[model samples]
Target: MSANLQSAANPSLSLKKRILPVWNQLGMLIILVLLCVVLALFAPYFTETNNILNILKQSSITAILAAGMTMVILTGGIDLSVGATLALAGVISVMLSNAGVPAGIAMLTGAAVGYTAGAVNGYFTAVAKLPSFVVTLGSMTYLRGIAFVISGGLPVVLQDKLFIFFGSGSLFGIPTPIYIMAVVYIAMFFVLKYTLFGRHVYAIGGNEEAARLTGIKVERTLIHVYSISGLMAGIAGVVMAGRVISGQPNAGISFELDAIAAVILGGTSFVGGVGRIQGTIIGVLIMAVLGNGLTLLDVDYYWQLIVKGLVIVIAVLLDKLRN
Candidate 1:
């Protein structure tokens, strides 16, 4: 009774020890709701059902990329090559389709290419002891080059009906990409929360040396992490190709930045091992809403870029604060 009374007497101590933590955890969700309310009030069409669905559909690609990125970043690493990988995979998939390959195989091949690229990244970073940033950056450059070379610096139109369905089709009035996003997030949530691999990722991010000492296959886990990242980018690439009905070597430029930003904004520590898949989904939604709202307000494209850059900076600052 005495201790309880003393604790109640110290409001500042209670706030610092209690309230702040809760705020840190929930700040993004609050921000998302507030942003939506403001946008709906200011942008007349923002609350329309069609516009809402469009936001989800358009944001699905980034959300997918961010999901993979969340895993990689949770291990205290980064992959700068995803954008390039998307372009390369998309290009290959389309070219294959044009060459009379079946639609399903072509899509799967694109995803495989992404996985292969990620595995290579994992090899250099995990086995060869190279920094992920340097390794992925090098891959980013070469992959983009390879994409351009293979596509002859031109876009390849995709005509496969089944392939296009994944990108632009809808079922039950919801866009297919949104459904894909849902599956990815649901699967990721389970993986991070309930799987041995997920626990290992967190452990490594917390302390790689300690995890290694404890018999975690640090190298193999990292390789898997990066490979998953690549795979997500590949899937996103296929969806993008389907949406546009073409494979452009230039698709997904700057996507890495957006993914990173979303992850960080969703309250994932940039240092790794202190985030959730649910938080990433909220972050993606915030980003999507911001962009959609700005467009509705008739903001110039250049200004939107500036706004997004500022948001990225703010997200980094928040991560630092959380750390």
Candidate 2:
């Protein structure tokens, strides 16, 4: 009874000890809701069902990249090559499709290529002990070069209806990209929550030396983490190709910035070791809402870029506050 009274008398202490820890995740959710409400009030078509679905569809590619990014960051690593890898996969998939390979097979091949790229990143970052930033940066440059070389700095257009449908088709009033996003999110959630790999990821990010001491296959796990990142980018690439009905070498430029921004905005610390799929989803939606809302309001594209940069800055500030 005395303890309860003392606690009640010290609400500041309670808030400091309690409210701070969970605010990182909750702050984004609250901000997202507030943004939605604001958009609904001011932006035409903002709250409409069609526009809502459209936003989800538009966000799918970035969300997919962010999902893979969550895994890489959880392992105290980064992959700057995703956007380039995406472009490469997209061109390769389209090339294969043009060469008479089936659409499904071509898509699979694209994902495999992404996986292969990631494996190389993992090898350098983990086995060769190179910094992830340096390794992925090099990969990013070479991969973009490869894309340009293969595509001759041009876009490859495919005439296949099935290939186009992956990006443009819908099921039960939802876009195909939405379905792909959903599947990717679900699988990521499961992998992060119920698997040893998930645990190891957190452990490594939190403390690599401790993880290595515990006999975890740190190098092998880091490789998988990056490979997964690459594979996700590949999937994004294929979908992007479907959307344009072509593979463009310039596709996904600056996309790595968006993916990394969303992951961090979702409350994943840049310092590593703390994040969740749910937060990432919220972050994805927040980013989508910002772009969609601003466009509806006729904000200039250049200004939108500025706003995005400011939002990232704010998000990082909030992260600092929360931590």
TM-score of predicted model 2? 0.96
Off by over 4 Å in 1: 1-10
| Per-model TM-score versus the true fold | 0.97, 0.96
Note the Cα lDDT for every prediction shown. 0.94, 0.91
lDDT of 2 by residue, 1-323 (tens): 87668769998877766776767648789989999999999996899999999999999999999999999987878899999999999999999999999999999999999999999999999999999999999999999999999999999997678888998888898889999999999999999999999999999999999999999999999999999999999999999999888999999998988898899889887767888988988998999999999999999999999999988787778667655
lDDT against true structure, model 2:
0.91
lDDT of 1 by residue, 1-323 (tens): 87667679997776677776897789999999999999989998999999999999999989989999999999999999999999999999999998999999999999999999999999999999999999999999999999999999999999889899989999999999999999999999999999999999999999999999999999999999999999999999998999899999999999999999999999889898889989999999999999999999999999999999999999999999888
**Top candidate, metric lDDT:** 1
